[model samples]
Target: MSGRVSHTVDMSVKLGELTLRTPVLTASGTFASGREFADFIDLERLGAVVTKGVSLEPWEGSPSPRIAETPSGMLNSIGLQNPGVEAFCEDDLAWLSSVDVPVIVNVSGHTVLEYVSVIERLEVEPRVDAYEINISCPNVDSGGMAFGTACTPAEEVTRACRAATSRPLIVKLSPNVTDIAEIARAVVASGADGVSLINTLLGMAIDIRTFRPKLARIVGGLSGPAIKPVALRMVWQVAGAVDVPVIGMGGITDTEDAVEFMLAGATAISVGTANFVDPTTVMRVTDGLAEFCRTRSIARVSNLTGAMRT
Candidate 1:
């Protein structure tokens, strides 16, 4: 009975050489591993699970008031706060391995060496199927601006990490740049297997009563529906610039947003802030995508990638 329903539309997508049975994946940091959403969603239903940013050493994250709610979105300076790669390999990876899904580790660092160190360690881990190089974390070593804003450093980091791991490398891009397409091409040239775009635009909030910044860091990554338009534009531009697979993310909350991204040239999509509002958002988007295709008489969801004429 279920086989007949699934055959109606092909939801599979390929990120570089890695194929995913579905096009929807969880945005790193937003979904955690599977512990938080495990009760709300079936891990096996997702195309892949992108774990939070893991570094060479444990990070305490930022100070108090790291999160601040905004209009239609939120700002977070939680930093790359993680239990380090070694600890993650022992704890998180164990929980992830038990689930029937591919794991894409989101790697972060203070320098190219830091990124390489984590990648080198995970290279031997059988549970790691792919890597999502988080060059977009805002509360990190250089406030996330040092590495992701320019083409040179982005390429340098991508090149170093590419050489350190055999697994697929997906460079997550920051929108806090002049030309995102330029950065996209730079990373792909440096050997990025794929690219994830529009990772939280740098933003800030002010408290009227205190006459001070809402967040302690003053500036943080902004994500939610508010950035969807910006994210879509960037995805479209980057998708046209790079030949490698482009994974789109930024304000994806519903199937409509996911479909829009695919039409903009996203080979795959990731659900982020929306997860906090609805734990089962990913599952809803997945099922919604299938129903959309069936109603439109579309045969495969992959066909939606870059389907826009202009």
Candidate 2:
């Protein structure tokens, strides 16, 4: 009886040799901590579910005031908070694999060796279907050596990890750079199968009343609708520059925005900060795409990728 009303669109999308059900995916950090979201959102319906970045060691995250709301977005210095790789393998992966979705595990490290160490461990595990290397973490030890923003460091780490891991590598880029296209091309040259764009723009918000920074970290990465225009523009620019697949994300709060990215040449779209406001956002976005196709008599969502023009 319910099947009559249920309309499932062909959400299949391919990343290199990998295929996804829906082009709509969840971003790394914006994900809910538990597996309970499956019932409400239908994880299987998503193109992919990217877990929060996992590190070689457990992270307590930045001190209090880790997040703040900006004019159109929010700033976060949550500091890549995640259980260590070993802990994730035991506590998270078992349940993550239990889900019907394809899980792309985001791996983070401070140095080339750190990146290699993490992926080497993951290579043996079946829990993660792919890897997204996060090279943008603001460094405290090196006085802030952001890997993705710097072309040299970005290429080095990307090459190191790409060589270490067997899974499809998606190099997540930093929007803090002066030239996003340059870095995107660098990663692809270093052997990345694909690239994920515009990882949080670095920003700060001041508290007028308190006469201090809005967040405890003093600064944070901005996400949400505020960065939508910039993200879309960068996605389009980077898409033109790089030959590999581009996973477009940022300020994607709805399906229309996802379509905008697809037209802009994004092979797939990801939902970031929206998850905090709506836990069922993934399903809503995927369902919205399906409806968009049905109304237009479109047969598959794949045809929508890169359908945009200048």
Candidate 3:
């Protein structure tokens, strides 16, 4: 174990031979709030950026008062509110071009045809580095539960999208599944190059006095430090079950948390909820990892990935 640990990793690891500079990336949705913070963190600094989930049609999203704070984490039902793909490309793609990072476009759809149509439009575009299909979005009531979090449509959705795009395809799995490893293996078998796990866990909160739901939507995806353990466990199981790389997320607030996931077998780590707490987390964590390797004389951060053994 120490022998492998001492070997330098070069900060570049292959996800089926496609190399990434660093394993630290901003989780989709968290890093997808337009380009306001793009200037704060050099977009080029990230391994890859998966934008927020964009729908075919502009969705008003869930009712207002969409968030609530939990002890170790926060609950949100932001819905996949976006300006639609056409608007996103027109206005947002410009900033994307300004950034030198690989933009992994995230697509959300209610049905098979819807998914195909969106990808088809993006397929012709130039700035996209990859596609992260979010199958476990629990906010919207309609297609929110449609594409994923279940076995039936999970494999079907992955197979359909794989046939549609020639670029690298990553299926974002939902922790809501009964046995997440089952779905992870299925995604790899269905032609997905990699998988991102534990898309927010499904949860709810209730107001004490009114005896009503705390949030207007009544339910939302739970994220933050609270879900870290769950995310780590799922990533561990899935990484062992599948051949493809695993991008781990959930309550990752710092470099240590990111290291935990890597040790658990995650090829990459995404900073999600932590972004809300501190917007500069992307650069902070990335720099911290670099420092970590430098101080420890560990040469490459990728060497930390999957360092655990049974």
Clashes of each: 0, 1, 1
Q: Candidates' TM-scores?
A: 0.97, 0.94, 0.93
In angstroms, how far off is 110's CA in candidate 1?
A: 0.2
Give Cα distance to truth, residue 121, candidate 3, Å: 0.3
Better of 1 and 3 by TM-score: 1
Residue-by-residue lDDT tens digits, candidate 1, 137-208: 877656255788888899899999989887899999999888999999999999999999879988999999
Ranking by TM-score: 1, 2, 3
Q: Against the hidden true structure, what lDDT does model 3 obtain?
A: 0.82
Residues 40-142 of candidate 2: C-alpha lDDT, one tens digit per residue: 6667667888888887878787887888988878888888777888988887788886777788888888778877888988888887899988876552233
In the predicted model 2, the residue pairs found to clash are: 11-21
Report how far residue 284 has shifted in candidate 2, in Å: 1.1
Q: Candidate 2, which ten residues in sequence have the lowest lDDT sum?
A: 1-10
lDDT of 2: 0.82
